[model samples]
Each structure stands twice: as C-alpha cells, then as structure tokens.
Target: MVEIKRPSPTDLLTIGEVVARTGVAASALHFYERKGLIHPERTAGGTRLYPRHVERRIAIIQVAKRLGIPLSEVAEQFGTLPSDRMPSLRDWNRLNERWRARLRARQLELERLQEEMTQCIGCGCVSLNACLVMNPGDQLGAEGHGARRLLPIEDEVPEGVGRDSH
Candidate 1:
C-alpha cells in the first residue's frame, strides 16, 4: 500500500485538519469563508490551506457566537484584521471592548423582558383594570405588531421596572 502523507503541524493545515483541530464543522468554515470571517489560502490544486493560527480564530468565533454575537457581526469585526495572521492580544482586547457595550445592553433588555414576563403572568386575558393600564386601546399595535406591549420601550418601562425598575 502507498504511504498516506499528513501535513506537518508547522505546515499549513487543510480544511479537514482545521475541522479536526477546532471541532468546528467543515461547513461552518465554508460559511465563515463565504461571510469573509476567515481567509484561507488555496493550493495550486485549489485545496484550502489555512494557517495554524486559524485554530485560534475559530475558537474566538465560537466564543463570540456563544455570547450571542451574530455571524455577520463577527465577520465585520474580523474583517478589520490582516487575513493571514493571528489576532494579537491587543486585537482581542479591542474586539471585546467593542462588544462589551452591546452585550451589556442585550443583557439589560433580556432582564427587562424577564421582569415583564414575571409581572404579566397573573393576568392572562382582558381584565377591567389591567386592560386599561396595559393595552390602553391597543396603542402598542400602532407601533407595528406582535406582542408590542410585551417588549416595552426604554421610556415605557413601568414605574418600577427598569434599571430603577429592578
């Protein structure tokens, strides 16, 4: 039988190697490529060859995803970097700083929703007092549609329900 050759750890890694190393699906890597999140080089025969640093990038992408950052957003952030190199610690710090505010805001919004959900649990239907106070002639519907009251606006947070609400 002919000997099967494998890429050395110091050499460029193929997509399959990246999948094995990173535990990210091959399809996701392709999607990352398409979205411009990752930039892999092509061999003369057209096989994708990723620098070893891609493993770290893939890990970063996974962490960002778990933090509820969208792939588009990840792509946008990663787009600021040089394609062939690993992101530096400073780069990671900058990325985190940029995402910190957005993540905090999202956390606040979710907390607000949770509070609203808890408060509104008792009244399941149109009641005399709750209806007048909550729906208020369906004014929320005018804003668009779909449980508008459930998602309260920043200014609309009830007397005791926002930052001060909690």
Candidate 2:
C-alpha cells in the first residue's frame, strides 16, 4: 500500500504550497518578502518556509489591495505588529478601522471630483458662460495643474439652489 503523508498543523508550508493555498503568485510572495511586508523562514537548503498564520496575513494584504490601498500603507500597518507574531483579532480590527477611514476619505474625494466634472464638463472650453462664475478666468490654473478648487465649495449659488442642489 502507498503511504500519503499530510502536513501537520505545525509543519511550515513551502512556497509552492502557499502559492497553491493563497492563489498569490510566487513572484509576488518574493516581492513582499523583499519589501519587508512578509517574513518567511528559510530551511538549511535555502527553501522558503511560511507559517500557517501567513495565510491570514496574505488575506489581509489582498483585502487592502482590493480596497485601493497601497502596498506601502499595508506594510506600514503590518510593521506595527511584532515580527515574531501574527496579528491578533484586535490588531486586525484597528487596522480595519484605519483603512476604513482612508477609504471613506477617498470616497469623498471621488464624489467631489465627480461633482466638479458635472459642473464643468468642458473646463478647457471658452464658450461656457457658467465657467466665469465657477472657475473665474481659470483661477485654478494658478494652483499648479489638474483640477484645483474642485474640493472647495462656494457659498453663493443661483437663486434658491444650494451647493448640493445639482
């Protein structure tokens, strides 16, 4: 009879095993290691061995990436934890809160940009009469480049319409 040996709970996973389990490319894992985002032990034979807890960390990283969070920001959060231990539930909660706030801020910024686009579809066109009131002779051009004053709101509006009327 052929014998099949299964990995025990304490057994470290090889890079290939982690790749199979996490669906993260081997190159990405290596890049994460190089960037100090993840720390994997090496066997005497110079093979990478990851602890089972790494799967959770990888999941967190994937979630952050999906949320449009940069790897550097994710790394900064991970760096707060002890190098020898995986993040506890409390740690994950704190990180989640921080990321949630960042995402909310980004959402607001995107909403503001969308509102500006609706206000001035052709910012470069001179035929827009409203541009004189909204942009005031391309005053945004002085604030460097690419969509300035888009975040700020003016008090004055047409008739009884408020800023959010449109």
Candidate 3:
C-alpha cells in the first residue's frame, strides 16, 4: 500500500500544497485546471481551494499522460469519481488500484528500456560507426508510435521470415 504525503492537513490546499500532493509543479496544476480536468473553487478573497481528491486525481493524470494516455481517457476515469466533493476511502482505493496497474506497466517498460540502453552502451562501440544507421531509408520512429520505443531496438525480425505461406 502506498501512502500519500499529506502536505496539507486543512480542508483547503494552497498551490504549493497541490504541487507537493500531486508531485506536479504549481504551474501544471494551473494548466490542468485551465484544461478543466481539475476545478478549484475560489475563496472570498479569490484564493483557489481544491478538495483533497484533486491532489490524487492530478497525480493520476500526470502518470497517465506520462504513459501517453489521451486527455479523454483521463477525463473518463475522473468522471468515475466525485470531483467537487471529497472522495470516500473506497473511492480512493479504487483510484489506487487503477494507478498501481498503470504503474506496474510503466515499471516493466522502464526495465526493458534499461536493458536496451545497457546493450547499446557496450565497450566495442563499433555500432556507432556502422552503416546500419547510415541508410536514409531506415527510420526507428517510423517503426512505432508513442514513447515506448524512445530507446533503441533490442531485437529485429529474422531475414526471409516475411515470405508468405504458399
């Protein structure tokens, strides 16, 4: 079980509070609110007041976006919870479960990326001078979308395997 650091104990959280609770920058919280994923109320003096749930939601949104989940997908998940109102423990638990699953996938991806990069960092370093990357026809980003392949390829298909069964 993960424990969120309660940076603010009061009902109202300041911009800095949001930053600490969400591990997001204060500017990002403002941007997300402007994007309508988070709605913070105003005080009599016009200070922004966010329910504690917004902190958790912002954390979830940050992770989801880092994984390249679209804003619509994050919105759909936010719709499952009561935004204007504080969430019950059950609601928080449900959010935690979803987050843990996403984190697990992200963890696996990072492990594989580490392996790929470690392979690329070999002492021989001859691959750097190889013509393998000199071909104008070859492109790595063209092979896949999203950040999953931001690292180098660890494997490529065998030659002659593209022949159709006859």
> What is the C-alpha local distance difference test score of candidate 3?
0.70
Give TM-scores for every candidate, taking all chains together and pairing residue i with residue i.
0.67, 0.68, 0.47
In lDDT terms, how accurate is model 1?
0.78
**CA error at residue 96 for candidate 2, angstroms:** 0.5
Give the best candidate by TM-score.
2
For every candidate in turn, the CA RMSD to the true structure comes to 13.8, 13.5, 14.3
Model 2 residue runs over 4 Å out of place are 1-11, 121-166
Can you list the residue pairs that collide in candidate 1?
Answer: 160-165, 161-165, 162-165
Writing each residue's lDDT as its tens digit, candidate 2 over 16-78 gives 999999999999999989878878999999999987778888898899889988899888998
**Relative to the unseen true structure, what is the C-alpha lDDT of residue 33 in candidate 3, on a scale of 0 to 100?**
83
- Candidate 1 lDDT, tens digit per residue, 39-123? 7889889999988877777888899889988888888888876676767789888988989989899999889777656667655
TM-score of model number 1: 0.67
RMSD of 2: 13.5
Rank list by TM-score: 2, 1, 3
**Number of clashes in model 1?**
3
Off by over 4 Å in 3: 1-10, 88-166
